[model samples]
Target: MEQELFTAQDLEELQRRGISLEEATQQVEDIRQGFPYLEILASASLEDGIISNEPSQEERYMSLWERYLERKDASVYKMVPASGAASRMFKMLFSFLDADYSEPRTEAERRFFDELHHFAFYELLNEACLRNHWKSIPKLLAQGDYKAVVETLLLPKGLGYGSKPKGLLLFHRYDKVERTALEEHFVEGALYARDSLGQVHLHFTISPEHQRDFESLVARVKDCYEEHYSVRYLVSFSQQEPATDTLALTPEGGLFRREDGSLLFRPGGHGSLIRNLNALDADIVFIKNIDNVVLDLYKGPTVMYKKYLGGVLVAIRDQVFGYLRQLDKGKVSHSQLEEMSAFMRDAFGIRLPEVLDDESLAPWLREKLNRPIRVCGMVRNEGEPGGGPFVIRETDGSSSLQILESSQINMADEGQRQFFEAGQYFNPVDLVCSLRDWQGKPFDLERYVNPKTAFIAHKSQVGRELLALERPGLWNGAMHDWNTAFVEVPLETFNPVKEVNDLLRPEHQA
Candidate 1:
């Protein structure tokens, strides 16, 4: 008798997608057991996990970063995850489209229409309305036909902005021109990511459907920025790999199937980007989300702090490399081992697991120093809807700095909820990472991941509720064992536009 759980065709399909039968079986097992919630020992604070620097220390880090940029062999790149669509940003507007009443019923919807002219895309929306509906926006507003204006802006007949990626949408307007989030990131890269040869390297993880649009936009604006900044631009794009897509399960834990009896697979979340990041060939990479940008006027602190984080990374890497060289020689004294242990605790927030005899110390130090390093910028939380920073004890009994989402926490536990609510800092997805080892070799990033950290989210497909598995988040579980450091960056450094109304904030304005 053959197994009916997975047929020969199913096995062939799995093999074609680079997924093994055992891996598929394990995924099924994971779905059965469900993901375990993360244990919260305590919230990482200014006193323990977060690094707050004085002005003098800031200057030193900046100088060090500039020196690192000037080094001949150094290669720096910026990676932005720009795959999310703008549908969520316009959720309220969509609701307005569906309302039975002629006018908006809620304060939020009324505010959107009352202040619609202030949006960066207002002119484009007006033009779209005039072109498609043969009616100008001002005329529609005069007649109290606000829905027509919104329809032209969001529907396919007009701008179709509701279906577009957030990166390509106009986010900020200046006297001369309006800029998209993608354009802002290009400007940002020129300011901080340029290397010794006056060249900027950038890679964007975009949806496959929007790759051509992104490429065309890059081509259109690259020359303008290059001329403006006197620097060459090398831009690249990647899509989420289909193989990373996870299987969906029905409400009863059975395999989800389409009407045609085929399996259902959904794109893994941002965690899948770890594979994309691992494939990049660079010494240093700066990772940030697409929407976390600001106007040029307020960009000074953001750019300054970016360099500060990079400088801190380079300084720490230099010391770690030096210590690695000393360990390689195998002539370290007891006091020297103690020094390395102290450095590990102070720099990475990791305590050496059970000190052994002298012979075992050198290998342990080498192993610890050889992994990839990342320095993340954390901002003080102010009622933001994002993950918080924490010190979590791993399965191996080693504790390290981690960025954790609220979903991962066991909110049912009173003590854990207290610590979670008391969290003082939020992860802004601002990171400066060193991917190369002391020997100048790329560290295999996949090895450091904690598979247990994968998330199973509740989602609906084809009007049916189902469970979806998301790979561990890139910063959260994806870099689980990397040497991590957290620096407290200013709130100004963490301006992200989660909703359309967020553009009304001062940071997004000219």
Candidate 2:
């Protein structure tokens, strides 16, 4: 298929949108290179598809448990990408810092800052302001030193938000808590005993601007864990530039940008973490977001589910490796060979298994039947956060488990409507995959990756008034391959502090 060449008009439009001609040209080149698969994806259909409702076979679960028992010594690596700006959180802090102290700040602002000061954010400020010995905010502000006051009071000691990194946000839920988000992640690693077995390592990816803060956060976390958990830190940080187009106007109504022409915005979807995950040298890696940590009370069930998922992967790996071995030895029949190849595609593409009633042609040698994938819940929960699991047809006329973002669904279609209505959905929390089997063959991420669809985000400025806007996200325009799965964890495990009101909830502040 011929690649679509970017027209001069398109380039001009990008430049008008603040993308330089040089960068625009590079983006065009990248798109051209990644476009062929998208064309193939565009031609596919998911009509008359039925979601898989079958339960996992008892034997399969037992086999998974068995593998978990045997490989109790195997290590697990956790990677949290923490290089985001706390601009959103700090914007609220700025409201406190810039308040009319003589008249008194609003109750809402006072309460938030009270919690912020009680939480580790204040200690971070104390450390930063040590030279000035800021006994009082009035004293610091009296000197007409707004930057120093901000640096001392608001900024974490070594890191500046946007100027530093998001992971270093002085993230304590309460005054008594000394852990930041970075520390919390390490704490989980320690709880999992990741460092002890050398089986689990915690790695953080940060931008170059925040490298020192990243190191400092690592050191602090190491110190805390060593004294408390007897766990050494396996923490490491990788430096990468934040995506350039992720900027937006601050709530105070001014544009925020990094030194690199990039907008200070949310990490461009966790999908961007794929490249970094691929670059890691670990045998087994668990990819998760920075803010997804549950409080210590909820950690047990969450970790159990994580282990269950990993156990399943270990069992599946053995089966796949056995089949591969047979294929390599030429010991498989023609029918078996075809079946093995089909499984390889389905496993990697994460495609939904074929339904028996579907009109699609059935292969002669089906090694395994379809089963439902889920994060088994011990309790009913609130609404699911991440994309749901769906059976989606790919460009190659095959189907797999696709994490369904509502943006990916064309709501105009009736089939999609029914499909959406019928299935149980779960958030993509921590996932499990085995590094090696009894025979010691490595697990291939490419084997489980869906390579069909990629995204082309539309950058636009939409608003209700004359204010300028920037919206760059993977919503409707983000094209993802269909093999996705959603497994619901417990409600206690999902506490996201999206707004100041959210912190007031006992689950977060408590």
For residues 178-203, what per-residue lDDT tens digits would candidate 2 score against the true structure? 45667777767665435333333787
Q: Where does candidate 2 have its weakest 10-residue lDDT segment?
A: 470-479
> Model 2 Cα displacement at 190 (Å)?
2.2
Q: What are the candidates' C-alpha RMSDs?
A: 1.5, 8.8
Considering summed lDDT, which 10 consecutive residues are worst modelled in model 1?
1-10
lDDT of 1 by residue, 1-510 (tens): 125677777777787888777777777777768888877667988888888866879999998999988999989999999999999989988888898876777988878888888899999998888887788888888888878887888888888889999999999999989999999999999999999999999999999999999998988888999999999999999999888888888879888888877778889899999999999999999999999999999999999999999999999999999999999888899999989988887888776566578888678778888899999999989999888988877665666788999888888999889989999999989999999999999989999988899978899996999989888999999998799999988888988888888999999887
What does candidate 1 score on TM? Answer: 0.97
Score candidate 2 by TM-score against the native.
0.63
| C-alpha lDDT values of all predictions | 0.88, 0.47
lDDT of 2: 0.47
